[model samples]
Target: MMQINSNPILAFLVTLIFISIPLSALAAKHNNATEKLSLNQDDIHGLWIEKRKKKLAVWIEDCGNALCGRIYWMKKPLDKKGQPKLDPHNPDTKLRNRPRCGMKILSGFVKNKENHWQEGKIYNPNNGSTYSSKIELSKSGILKVRGFIGLSLFGKTLKWERPEQKLQHCG
Candidate 1:
């Protein structure tokens, strides 16, 4: 005959280790899921800042049943003469006097099949050129904006970050 004995503490220790390991893994997974960025289209409405090197803050919002964004703020809103910065580089001479601040730089962005904003135009105040553009908000909260003349393959993408605090429009 074989003799069998049960130890309560040893059994409890085994149970705890077995239970806690999977529980820990599950907890970590849940945390990661919660951290994932929102995929909802409306989540894109907010203030975004490009690389500080540009010193620009853009405000994105719903407009005319689509997405639109504008430059509401700039680090230097004035020119050397202490006057509002103008879009002198614009091809259209009439629009050259428009202020860089409060300019409608992004327009006509509609949601595409992939939920990204597409079929839009982004105006480059630097060179006063407009390019067909598309935008996507990533799972990590980075705004990926692409500007291309013809195909997306022939373009550049810029990553914009969200500022921690509210930024006042250029004054």
Candidate 2:
């Protein structure tokens, strides 16, 4: 057996090679994970439906420099009068008469970092409430949406699924 002190330079080089191998591997793994988490414009540009209530479907599309989602369809489109549903709960009386379909419910969302969309607001037609929202896309094709009153800790999280691409239309 050779003594390490007898050839210090060779021993150091061998140790460095072993250390660099794992470091390089770790760096590569981090890069791949970041890439997988990153979101692209097209990744979210489609119809997404609430995982719980299949009644709501939103069409996400590019709007200006950000992304917006519009209520394209509803399971129950007609009201008591057999007329298309209106946003009666809307705070603005002027908009109350407007149909719910084709109404933009998600707005002002811009990609902030990989896999995240921030600085957005989500309107809840069910209660006529709006809240600050952020969205994160998962590798499993689910959009995790968080709606908060003020702080995120006081918010609700809901999962929306990207259904099979279909010719979705608003009623």
Candidate 3:
């Protein structure tokens, strides 16, 4: 008859190694998911259009130490009078005559620790309303723009996509 030698210390060590292997694998998987969410901040610098309403194209670019976005083009730049659309809803009557196509609707977007553009403002020409905004680039290559009244919970997120073809900027 053969007798098997049993060591408590060896058994415990083997058990711990087996447990740690799965835990380490789980951690690696989590890290990879996090890496996919962490995108380059510079990737935001380009033209993006609203996914739902393709009426406007906003061009995001480096402005000073932060980022700013301007209205690069419009599907219908002219008003019924055949004149360039103006900001009639602007609070300042004197500034209402300004064209909407070249307006800077997004400003002061600073990249934060979470790889999102935060502490920015987005202007809505439709109502001449400015809201606190933040932007995030999703893993699916969608530019998510959130405009909030006060806090983020009271906000709406709009998806903007990078156009595959060339755009007629301001044309």
- Which candidate should be chosen as best, given lDDT against the real structure? 3
Whose TM-score is greatest here? 3
**lDDT tens string, model 1, 47-160?**
888854658889898889889898978888889999999899999999999888889899999998554889999999999899999998776677889999899999999878
lDDT of 1: 0.83
Q: What ranking of all candidate models by TM-score puts the best one first?
A: 3, 1, 2
lDDT of each candidate versus the true structure: 0.83, 0.84, 0.86
Instruction: Flag regions of model 1 displaced more than 4 Å.
Output: 1-42, 52-54
What lDDT score goes with residue 165 in model 2? 42
For model 2, what is the C-alpha lDDT against the true structure? 0.84
Alpha-carbon deviation at 36 in model 1, angstroms: 12
Candidate 1 vs candidate 2, lDDT winner: 2
Scanning candidate 1 in windows of ten residues, the lowest lDDT window is 33-42
Ranking by lDDT: 3, 2, 1
Candidate 3's residue-wise lDDT over 89-156, tens digit each?
98889979999988999999999955488999999999999999999987677899999999999999
The C-alpha RMSD of each candidate to the native structure, in angstroms, is 9.0, 12.6, 12.7
- Per-candidate count of clashing residue pairs (backbone under 3 Å): 0, 1, 0
Local accuracy of candidate 2 as per-residue lDDT tens digits, 8-62: 9988988999999999999999996665444332388777888888788888899
